[model samples]
Target chain A: MTKRPRYFNLEPIMNPKSIAVIGASDNPDKIGHVILANNVASGFRGAIYPININASGTIMGYTAYKSILDVKEKVDLAVVAVPAEVVPKVVEECGRAGVRGIIVVSGGFSEVGRKDLQDKVTRSGMKYNIPIIGPNCLGVTDSYSKIDTLFLPAAKIDKPVVGGVSFASQSGAVGSSVLDMIDNEGFGLARFISYGNAAVVDEVDILNYLADDEKTKVIVFYIEGVQRGKEFIEAAKRAALKKPIVVSKGGMTDEGAKAAHSHTAALAGSHQAYEAVFKQFGFIMADDIQELLNLSKIFETQPLPKGRRIAILTNGGGTGVLATDALYEHGLQIAEMSKKTVESLRKVMPPIVNVRLPLDMAGDAEKTRFEAALAAFEADPKIDAIIAIALFQTPGADENVAAKLVEYGTKMRKPMVVVSPGGSYTKRQRQIIEKGGVPVYESPGEAAKALAALASYAEYRDSHVKKSR
Target chain B: MALVEYFEAERLLKKYKIRSVESRYVKSAEEAEKFSAGGRIVLKAVSGKALHKSKSGLVVAGISGGEIGKAYSALERRAAKYRPYRILAQKMVHGGIEIIIGGSEDVQFGKMILLGLGGIYVEAFKDFALRVCPINMEEALSMIRQLRSRKIIAPDRASEKMVAELILKAARMYQGGRMKELDLNPIIIHDGTYDAVDIRMIK
Candidate 1:
């Protein structure tokens, strides 16, 4: 049997032991200068080489090389942030210096209809068998490796802590915004790559790399279009079997497709086609960036539900109804409690509370009532997952509710998600629930959606495993 | 791009073991009369370049055997504006749901197969399912179930299998690089049997 050819070996590009920042500027406002400062500040353990033509001495306290060729040491990676016209020559010189990876952070190529210039840089990299990340992009970051190449200043965009979720995006602006959003929300990341104007490496290459990455447990993609559909599907299918992949496609509408074309020269083909592919490959398709983050956080922290039957436990009747509706909308069933379980629930529950699927515990229910309800549901054979909504505003509910949920979430085999929606107190409760190793969402709808993602992944995994057998 | 005439398109479909309604190309009224003796027939003007035959008055359907001569002359006169024209005589098939099976080369993704409810459903709702080429029978059946009009085939497992097989065959043919686009519109299915009534191929 013939072995398949590897299109990308992204280790050197993503986790380089030694890096050279070409076009490194002393000015704080320049993109090159910001990228260099970020690398130094982020505490990269590898050797850093700053290349500049006019500067002679140290830049940001690191020895500067006048040219990449002048550097006698072996350079594993080159960060090119020069003018677009000079990128091709710089890439050719890097190729001669035997660099393994190149990341060009210039914007004048391809996105502005300058294909020739992009092609020149691409050919130079190809001639030396070096993979290029972008012609116009913010570059990459590996939180575990402390490799931060993004041009945005640290004051402007906060770097997330190292975690299990990694992301690959096609647009630099959107990628940076999402990074900031996830950081603000206290979600951590393992790796991030924004390959804008993908002249060489695309999402498929990055996805393949992340699939085998040891630290990453969930892969996220914010893609506008795919250039090579067959390769992408193959890579995504392989990755999805081992871990969950959450994707939010950008151009689902005709108008958005047109906009995506000018943005990255992406041919956003028929939306129906994309939908079909996503369904067939078992990829969790998020409708927006917020949902993408929500799904990612859940996938990273929770186990997949063995089945789709979910039991919703909420203190508020209105929130319970909304949770039921959202669960049904996502094709998850509200578990019909057994007669025995309902009999046990009727003993402790108030008469006003309904002992049905969305087991409303009533607003005045205390912590023990919540624990008893959760214990009854956890013992029931029919329930595969639980979405517990804790309304912190109620007088009877206290911070101990979060602790009870954490106990059940960690002790039980079934996956559990919490919904704590409200003002400052609720936000603080959410953080406590999250810190205890359970995903917490602001809305019942988001909690339901996250559970649905888990159930859908389980179904996909089952179908694929059966096929392989 | 090259156009494949109706007769040629049906020939390709038949070669792939997909059943197509029996059709014969004739240059004269006598040949049309001979081919239409079994039952009512559909007369269409055959030109590689001309599409939308019904809208252009190039198609006359539901013609009995006795009306072959008159229908053939009417179609000939209507197609006078189109060059290198002939007539296709096809047996009028009935009593089956209308479904479309097609394959096209996407710009980003290579070959892909499309399945949807044919006739007005495809034009009005645009409800369709697509998959990359070389799909298996199980994958093809899953695509059919993905359609919004899935209830139409919910109870008929045999019909579902036949539709799935037809899609797979079309996708395999497309992957061979012989054609860029292929359409089998209004494929009639009843009692677990399917017939490709109309075919168009763009090479």
Candidate 2:
């Protein structure tokens, strides 16, 4: 007589009609008070519960309740921010109150090396068919719904509807950084989830759920390890065939490997074996956070690359050479310009500019040269993708020129990634390029990696496409 | 790249019809003398550590009748200098191409059959190719193609069918998983016929 734990859609918490914030406190820094504040700011519609044992009145302007049993209406989601030992009891009470989902924001379960507490939480969820997100987790956010289940400060802009990129992370800090990357780098996100510790709910279940999520067309994950490799691989393969699934695994060194094993008990086997597995499952391996963002932007915007050949359009010799080196290091061939592509470029490019492989145009006064190179590569049938490296050397190096080139590159529908390196003022250039629906990177290595990932996606698409045909 | 003594290695190769250099295990000087008197002979220590008998003063080649006793005492002294060992008297096989055929189990692909140019040059050049076992003629041919210095397969050097057949036989032996490894180095090819000079098998 034991019951199995039931899992449900994330929609209940993500789009709840009513939410009960248990352990709501008077102190602003307290977990309960922060949870209430986030809920209020997030604009959750329906009844709210401020559960407190000895509060004199309301907290955060919400009517206070003595307990979950004191809440009058049916609760769809419950946010638990209580002491470690009392969490299982609170979860049991929430279950009895018919809460559909619970986001446990406490940290003393499996995360603190307490399997006993973890078991209690698990049993409570099983008894009531409740879907618990975490025992030690920074919650989720649905920007469209104005839901900020997390306590982190919100960005000062519209929640981007840039479709198709959802992020999943094992580390909450990395997840926060991803949100900041979205705001700062303009890489759009569809949804974000940080399942810390993953004692009750692990990566496989979340990935399985995301597999059916309509909003998620591309999923980026930062995983230290996986508890179930075969299950994860199967789910990833199924998800990746339809959409790109990119992973940046964090444990390559011995110390990191040991940490990874203790964290999730993942084999974290040979790094090469992991790489081979990624190749077999058709998942792109991102080397860094910037590269990760760049790849996501590409998947959001252009068609997958058709080949590994790349054309570079730059305003400076150093930038062009660096871009070429990165492209080559990632096993991409320098694209040979076609006769028609060269003809188009010859019209706008300065005579002194060499329209060769990198199409390194003249430095400084290279606005025309930059546009000319972009035009050529966009029209070139041989080129699979293009990396446009724009440097902010002088005022004549108009940012608009780079942005327009990006527009044309997007119009061509070939994979084009931009590398814009400068101080804070280059925001306009970056925003324009991104708004034109093209991927951009801050460094040449990031841009090249993005292109490489795009090429991998294209290769996978080609094989599957050909097979289907 | 490690070698097992001649008597032990020949036992494994014979199972695959890859005959070895004609040799006899001799417990005493009488047996060694009888083997040497039969034909052109090469006397060696049979202990595993006594790999290069010539270097260890354990080998006396091309000797006739009464020479076997003197060679045995010299080999015993050299071998006893390090550890105890046995003596093997084998026929001196000359006039052939020295090639190596062996296998080491690969961690990823499981048991792999290895083939390359044999003798001391094998280590010098590090020329080798490996294929996962249960190999047929086609896989055997591919291994030959994977060699770093593949010119060893030239028409003047080796007969195509003979080398291919030998590789396939070795692959089959490994694929069975009954044996752990097989190293038949310096497998001599004479007048278009292949003969294993030495073989090492571990299970």
Candidate 3:
């Protein structure tokens, strides 16, 4: 087991009891106004104090103080949305006012080649022992705490429901976009943090905090670069032992490195180095945003598959073939069903249906066929996981297949993923399957990929546990 | 970066308990002949600046005692562009899988160890796996297994263990931080025994 050092406790920043919004303004176009409005509309239970130099009247239903110094009550966190040049002075003032944490939502610091100014802001935090989240970031959102510091309006970026998955990103735009996309996909989030520029609190610190956060079951990251490689690996390794971690890194190519650096002042080192580190720590390295979300959702809902032997149960032959190809591509095996399982499947499946590994039950496979196939796979000792392709576009298939999947998925105690791809009809079925606590994907390949992620995590956990023992 | 000479790198590998083929450095053709009297030998011209010796005609293999003198003169003349070079007489090793093990200090991840297939087709295949230094035996074995040609080593458990141990040793040596980069290409492995035939190091 790797020994974990005492990381900076981020409770004050993530779960603050009292939060002060700096640069608060009455102008709706201002970032400060949107951020203050978001906090208020999000129903943050904490005491909200708005700080503005000139404004004396109420702002966003909260009385605006002249400055942070004027606020008489104790402030656990200060969300600063001021301009770039004034950020360092504001940080110093926040530090002097005994703020425990500060989230600098304003841009323009090291990202714009102003290293000296960024250093001054960082120094202020260090001198006062207060952690700073970012100098160029969207800030954080904790659904559990009802703290939404993101300046993006709720209308444009809908908040996801409170759930077990938490994400920490180095890019604000990517983080916000993913959050919005997840809301549309019916995936929920426990916490979301976009720590751009990472002047003080970086991905490593957030990962450590989320490792112990009760609400966060699976931790995800959108990393452009790592400031402290060794520390990040250690923290990630520890976190992964307790909960699954999926990472999608930017700046993999040479051209992307330049953009990453300009966007977040990230180092953007060689991709091979990051790959090795991820493999060493047993992290699920997702190739894109969608894959990251897919892996996170699977890890959040499904138990890790005991082995790699997967039984593909699909209604469409094409989907089955695609799932088979994806399973092989991901290094997962297509299980050879036992004779007993084949006999059981033979009793329910039609004569035309081949009792093979990817048992394609034709387009007419309805709820009964799915139930029979699920039962056979559940009883088969050779099959460790199942990927059920429930295509709702088929006329004979019904929504009851989702209920059957839930029943069998729980009874089997094995990981199961569903691929229900199509238009409105399939989307409705997918929502039904999702509500039944089964992860649903738009394609067979994605379903197979999710199973692969689960199998890989299981193998990694098993190996690590054996080694520790 | 400062390059370490071939003989110096061999000595360093030996000091770290990594097996290297025995070789003697000679300045003259007569010394080459004297060193190549035992068996078939490989004659190589040692120059710090010359990286691709075989491509430059500075390396001659399968040189018996009689051919040592001619090979030595040819190599010295071929390497005349980079003057002030010595000749190395190494016993010819045969019939082994060519493998490459290396390590370099990455700017972000610190020291990283690399394992891959070697020989002339190394560039064409580009099959390799990398891991951070100070890796355990399990990690080293996984690095070997990650290669596309893993089947070649799967049947021979002894060879697998040797390759894994070699990687771990190289990672340890790299973690010492003396050399900025090290390459032990074409490490021949036959019947579970291995020998590092060529070495390169940059400080």
DockQ of 1: 0.33
Tens-digit lDDT track of model 1 for B26-118: 878888777878588888886654665665788888888678888888788889888677888888886778887777665666677888887
- Evaluate model 1: give its TM-score: 0.91
lDDT of 2 by residue, A231-283 (tens): 66667667777788888877866332432201011122245345545655678
Residue A332 in model 2: lDDT:
89
The TM-score obtained by chain A of candidate 3 when compared with the true chain A: 0.92
**Candidate 3 local lDDT, A1-469, one digit each (tens):** 1222236678899899999999888899999899888888899988999988887788877888988988899999999998888989899999899999999998888988998889888788777878789989989999888888898877776668878899999998899889988765656799999999988888888989999999999999999888888888789778888889899999888442432201011222378788888988889999999898888888888888889999999889988889899999988989999999998888888999998979999988889899899988888889999998888888768878778976776556888888888898778777777766678888877888788878888888888888887
Better candidate by DockQ, 2 or 3? 3
Q: Which segments of model 1 are wrong by more than 4 Å?
A: A1-5, A253-272, B26-39, B63-73
Show the lowest summed lDDT stretch of 10 residues, model 3 chain B.
B149-158
DockQ of each: 0.33, 0.07, 0.40
Off by over 4 Å in 3: A1-6, A254-269, A410-412, B153-155
Candidate ranking (DockQ, best to worst): 3, 1, 2
Between candidates 1 and 3, the DockQ winner: 3
Span of ten consecutive residues with least summed lDDT in model 1 chain A: A259-268
Which consecutive 10 residues in model 3 chain A have the weakest lDDT in total?
Answer: A259-268
Candidate 1 residue pairs in backbone clash: none
